[model samples]
Target: MIDKKQWQAEQAQFNDTSRYNDIMDKPRHVSHAHLPMTGRDRAGQFAPFAALTGYHELLNKIAQRYVNKKYPTGAEEQAIFDFFHQLPTGDAVRLELTYFNGESGYYEHYRGTLDHVNWAQQVAYFADGPQIPLRNIRVVNRKGNAHGQG
Candidate 1:
């Protein structure tokens, strides 16, 4: 490698602008062939974008890998109904609700406090804001209860 003095001398020579005296103060050339791009248009070229167009579809497919809606058996359904009826309306009850999601064809587990049940709509309202259909429920577990019915 060159010594420090030799590198400094080379850098000094490179920094000299006397050689470009003719064009040092000249204006920047403007292109006549193409119109100027707006700031928004110029930024669009380097802006963030989704390279994989169908990436969301791929994720959905992966999520549905094990999807096959499971229905409760006759005895299990009876147990689920019996458990649901026992819960007092407008009472705070921590529960683990296992219900089938028709769109994804998979069982979904929601753990939260039961707010109330809308009997006319056949939906169970939870404090955390999920209104699940009674028919879709496959399993229900009341928190602190060792035995859960499915």
Candidate 2:
């Protein structure tokens, strides 16, 4: 059974209006940038869920796919996995997320940097699927979109 407290914490972090309008679009909740890292020690620490879950393996897949690219650390990977492992999985997904400005926090501004910015300004994060909790880094239609600029 899913741990009540652990699931609650994950749910709290992932609590956002999640609606996928299309399979070809990003999650209205989580972007595709911050992919979770599967813990190397699947036999311990997170063994409770890892015992009967595929998310651990999925984390490894996500790491192998974009581990070196995002400059992620061991803890960051674990955090990502602990967050998204709640969602259903099938096909592997390539995720991305918010852009940063210096080191204030997360990129939450929608100022339209280039006016006609043609590229998909949405932050991308790779995951096992699109049902993951996607907050902190959001866009206009995105859930975690912040306001104002520094």
lDDT of 2 by residue, 1-150 (tens): 357998998887787535533553654466479764457754467668746677767666655544323334555544443434433355442233433332333343322222111124322233332221222323222134222121
Q: Give the clashing pairs for model 1.
A: none
Per-prediction TM-score to the true structure, in the order listed: 0.48, 0.18
TM-score between candidate 1 and the true structure: 0.48
Please give the lDDT score at residue 9 for candidate 1: 100
lDDT of 1 by residue, 92-144 (tens): 88988778876667788889988888778888888889888877887777765
User: What is the Å distance of residue 99 in model 1 from its true position?
Assistant: 1.3
Candidate RMSDs in Å, in order, are: 16.9, 26.2
| Span of ten consecutive residues with least summed lDDT in model 2 | 110-119
lDDT of 2 at 20: 34
Best candidate, lDDT = 1
